[model samples]
Target: MLQLEIVTPEKKIYSGPVHDVYLPGSEGEMGVLEMHAALVTSLVPGELRYTVDGKTEALAVGTGFAEVTQERVLVLTDMAAGEAEIDEAATEAAIERAQQQLDQLDHDHDLEEVAMLEAALAKSFAQLKLKGKYKGLQ
Candidate 1:
């Protein structure tokens, strides 16, 4: 078993032993299993999946970093939510709000604010997609 922990600024979302983990790495999707190489990688706003007790579970994760070791995988993300935790309507509203903010940006707009808004929009879309994909399975 490999210890898997997913943490956000507000709380520790998950902490347990998992059979395997699939991360949305910046380079691409990467899978981790027991005794995998030790490494650190940046994560993208996308779906993160893990298997435990022969059952697979998923979470929508925002941009962050992950540290992988032989026995553990620790993820520190801006946002992380299980499929059931995501509210489709709320996510849609957030996407709309972020788009509006992006649209309001001018030529002289701050790059930092633009980047943040874009990240928010991306995260919202990822959450919505995961929620929609798993809605029927739930």
Candidate 2:
């Protein structure tokens, strides 16, 4: 098994051994099994899955970073949410809200506002992708 730990500024979301893990990379989805080589890479907004004690659990994660060591996998991200924590309606609403802001913004938009909107869009996309893949599990 591979030790998996996920952390955010708010709290430590998870810490334990998992048989396998899949992360959404900026390039594409990546799967790591036991004894995988060490590496650190950026992740994009998408679904993250890991099998723990025979049961597979999925999470919606936003763009961030992941470090894979010989024995442990550490993920640091701005957002991480399980199925229960993810509200589809709320996420969809957030996408709409962000889009509205983008539309109303002036010709010369604030960089901070633009970044916030982009982040919101990524988060919402991750949720939708996770929900789509694991509907029965969710």
Candidate 3:
């Protein structure tokens, strides 16, 4: 098993042993089993899945950094939401809000603001995807 820890600025979301984990990467979704090779990579906003005690759980995570060692996986991100934490209506609103901001952004808007908006869009989309996939199960 691999010790997986996911943390966000607001709290330490999850910490436990997992048999495997799947992350959304810039290139594509990737899976890591126990004793996998060490790696440090950037994570895109998407669904993160892990198996524990023969059951799998999923979370919606924002852009972050992931450190995968021989026995551990550490993920630090701005946002991480489990099924119970995700509110479909709120996520949809956020997506709409992000789109509105992006649409109103002027050509001369600050780069930082633009990036933040983009991140919000990504996070909201991720939540939407996860919710869609596990709606009935949840």
Best-fitting candidate, scored by TM-score: 1
Clashes in each model (backbone N, CA, C under 3 Å)?
A: 0, 0, 0
Q: What TM-score does each of the candidates earn?
A: 0.96, 0.90, 0.93
Candidate 2, 27-108: lDDT as tens digits: 8999998888999999988888999888989899987899998889899998899887778898899999999998887737
Off by over 4 Å in 1: none
Per-residue lDDT value at 86 in model 1 = 91
lDDT of 3 by residue, 26-129 (tens): 78898988888999889999999999999999999999989999899999988899877789998898888888888888747567888889988889888888
Of the candidates numbered 1 and 2, which has the greater lDDT value?
1
Q: Which candidate do you rate higher for TM-score, 1 or 3? A: 1
In model 2, where do residues sit more than 4 Å from their true spots?
Answer: 106-109, 136-138
The lDDT per prediction is 0.94, 0.89, 0.89
lDDT by residue (1-138, candidate 1, tens digit) is: 999999999999999999999999999999999999999999999999999999999999999999999999999999999888898998999889888888888736578899888899889988998988888885
Ranking by TM-score: 1, 3, 2
Query: Candidate 1's C-alpha lDDT?
Result: 0.94
Output the TM-score of candidate 1.
0.96
Which residue pairs collide in model 1, if any? none
